[model samples]
Target: MEHSGFLRRWGTLSSFFLVLLLAWGRLYAQTPSTHWSDEDRISSQVIKLRNGITLNYAVQGDPNGPVIVMLHGAGDSWHSFARVLPLLPANYCVYAITLRGHGLSDHPARGYSRADFAGDILEFLDQLHIQHATLVGHSLGSFVAQKVAEQDTGHLDRLVLVGSGPGTHKAGSSEDEVTSPFAKLTDPIPYTFARDFQASTIYHPVPAWFFEMMVGEAQRVPAATWHGLGASISAGDPLEDLKKIKVPTLLLWGEKDSIFHREDQEVLLKNISHASLKAYPETGHALHWERPERFTSDLLAFIHSNGPNP
Candidate 1:
């Protein structure tokens, strides 16, 4: 009887181990092997908008192919998409921009509102003579993209919003309160604070190099810019304005995202006329960082699809 019991327990343990191995294999297959060397093929450039703001950006792939304009989140530069860019096909013309008051972009004393950022993007399209392009934005950049789409510049072909919310100002939310952490930030942001902030956005493991790169990027932003951007994000509710967006929209959110809840995505879907949502399982706010390979696949599929806008 003792021998029989031991055999039964061993069989169960083996089965459990097998299940875990398979699950890990699936996750490993979906992650990109991104390295700092992957950025070597990308070229950096700067363009001065008509408003006299010089924006730094990185470009890759064929210039004549379908255009993709990527806007990074607050305190992030074009490097935010470093992993995704290398995984993209050679047929795409990707431009990842560093928004004003961040990265190497010009930092004005003011004008950090979403509308101001949208104006810069429109002017950028005009200057580059890009007739049509897909606009991709993450977090704060998503709000800016929405503002751009509202203007109906006739240049946006599609829209992709990652880690986005309907709006940043929830009446009783701790982050929106006047005494929020962002409100207390001062110049020369501490390395630990920046590291912790970046760490809080991801649930899965990323390359240590990539995480440190992101932390460095966060520290580059001035406290005043952070204050301005934070205020702009909370200043208005874009729920009604989202109705003005006529292009096909895709929202990619992480299931584990604490910053923006699932309800926020539902609110976005209800407001945007032709928007759809794809939630990533076990992922956090920085889904792309955690699952770059999967993110690229989904983005390409959306771009190639000709389904009727619903």
Candidate 2:
């Protein structure tokens, strides 16, 4: 009787969730995030790189304050940063870059290394003639942020690595993903790029439409880009370079992150000098998206309290 009752309850809940997903697909149907936005009310720049790669970036808030350069992770465009932009305190200029092949940016044949992305950022800053900026990176973006700091850019203020490590961490490839429906219990993929960041969390009063938007985003990227980039970021260990980074660094992790586990966090903390560590409970890799208010509050407090930008 107990087993039977449990099965019945599980079935009922599953059915309910299915309906929610379908409703989101129909009711909140949104076009591909890649759709261009004109009149965004934000300063926009199109940078053509030295290697024939073109990237798109958007700036918001006070243009005069210390600059903040944000980098998104794999399979995500600048839209991933869309949530935190408006929440930023006024007078802080924030620039979000859409990586090649992700959003409006052109997909180049190669040159997807961390250095490649950092080079683009360096060029972008030089073009604008900005001297210094705070670097905020999420996931793969975190890795890029470290590189920028290492370059001795003379303008790098500090580094905030969200849901990422100071160096290479244990993540897997698409082939390593366990896709069985029951396998949902074991998340082999980082929630950020999967577009399932919402479902991977234990967010209370979970907004019904957030996960649905992720599904829409996954559909926008071709299967090749999805699998290729995931493989790329997970392919090697990049943490040995962490010691080279001299800027003040903040390392954040999701409590429930399956990809970059606590072990990964500790290892990163050990390598990077006195890197401050913070973890969100019951949250997966995309805590920022899953819990925006709490995430921003914690982020801003840390930023303001840190001794005058390193």
Candidate 3:
């Protein structure tokens, strides 16, 4: 293909969105991630940050066991990992985090970038007195987790990234949409052109109930907050920072992920040494939610094989 033809071919509107999502961290992806409930066999609490921010959190399994922090995607609460919680061994303790502005966490007026989110996680860990643990992040959470690891490499033992976006400096908009509250945020919450672009995402049989639940949850977010938070998620580049990570890592992407294309995964594997990649066939953006059994089982097997991070 000629240069212009190739550019046009690769320059689909959705393709640029794929780049934005890979770069910006937050995109409310909460499906089952409503507020923590008692019937779910989970315990909930609030982690208070020194800055007067209170982040809502939940825990499942033995509290005294080795720590495993769970981070949700953008627009989602910690409960997004609800199904995966039961699959863990009793010896492992898990804490699910709600991003500052989403879920029940306190949303400040400013400080909405991935770096801010990473700092929030650090504060959460500090409050819990959790000295060390492995970190697992999904989508937007993956961005924050990646950023968090950069802040304190010593704090993360093993890192697991699920359906993580790539590192792009651009936010992928043809015109300046940040003119207003609604314009600043990504439409599908993940991509600016998600309604049309999501076809390129993951490939699971999207159930009606899940879609409805996600849609409803997202609709509740105030337009201004959502857009402002969305703007914050896409403000910077984390690709250069990715090279700073030396910890053992596992990178997983749904084979059908339209949000993060194959090229994005290739970039990750190429850049991160000691990183392994797995593509879940028939799965889309929400790999864990779409195939809980397979995702959790694969996660368990990988962690067991690697043993605890030293």
Q: Write the per-residue lDDT of candidate 2 for residues 103-165, one digit (tens) a residue.
A: 678766456667777887777777777665778888777777777777865877677898885
Which candidate number would show the highest TM-score if scored against the true structure?
A: 1
lDDT tens digits, residues 1-310, model 1? 9999999999999999999999998887666544445566689999999889999999998888888899988778888998799999878899999999899999887898898999998899899988568899998888888888889668888999999988647766634642256667997988987888888888988888789999999899888888888788668664788899999999999999868888889999999988999999999888888999999989888888833221
Off by over 4 Å in 3: 1-40, 170-202, 206-210
Please identify model 2 stretches exceeding 4 Å from their true place: 1-45, 169-210, 307-310
lDDT of 3 by residue, 118-208 (tens): 8989888877778557789997789888888777746667788998755564545311232223455543454333332223333675556
lDDT of each: 0.85, 0.67, 0.70
Error of 3 at 176 (Å): 11
Q: TM-score of each candidate?
A: 0.85, 0.73, 0.76
After TM-score superposition, the amount by which residue 138's alpha carbon in candidate 1 deviates from its true location, in angstroms, is 0.4
C-alpha root-mean-square deviation, each candidate: 10.2, 12.5, 17.9
- Give the poorly placed runs of model 1, Cα more than 4 Å off: 1-37, 174-179, 307-310
By TM-score: ranked, best first: 1, 3, 2
TM-score: model 3 vs. ground truth: 0.76
Error of 3 at 280 (Å): 0.6
